[model samples]
Target: MVKHGISLVEAARRLGVSQSTLYIALQKGQIPTFRRDGRTVVSSGALRDYQTGKRPPCAYRL
Candidate 1:
């Protein structure tokens, strides 16, 4: 079955950013996340929105 969400690490890789950078974004709420099986994951659609500049601009630069 295809996964609907991706791990933070995988998300970082797909975004071409470091995990620390992704964590920073998470902290700032720039990226949305959800708990799945006690682990944090981001939905594919959300990631796509972020990549497409659909998310609001972050106050802190990444």
Candidate 2:
């Protein structure tokens, strides 16, 4: 069967960011994610939106 989403590591690689940075973004709600087959994954569309600025990054609060 084909996968609907990509692994977190792949997502980080595509975004050219470290896994820790991606994790922080996930925690801050900057990036959305879901669990599939017991593993966390991110949708390609969402990643594209983020890259294109369609999904603006969340503001950091002090």
Give one digit per residue, the lDDT tens place, for model 2 in 1-62.
66589999999999999999888877777778878899989999888887887765667632
Residue 32, candidate 1: Cα error in Å is: 0.4
lDDT string for model 1 (1-62, tens) is: 55568999999999999999889888877888888888899998878888897885667664
Q: What C-alpha lDDT, on a 0 to 100 scale, does residue 46 get in candidate 1?
A: 78
Which candidate leads in TM-score? 1
Give candidate 2 regions above 4 Å deviation. 1-3, 56-62
**Candidate 1 stretches greater than 4 Å from native:** 1-3, 56-62
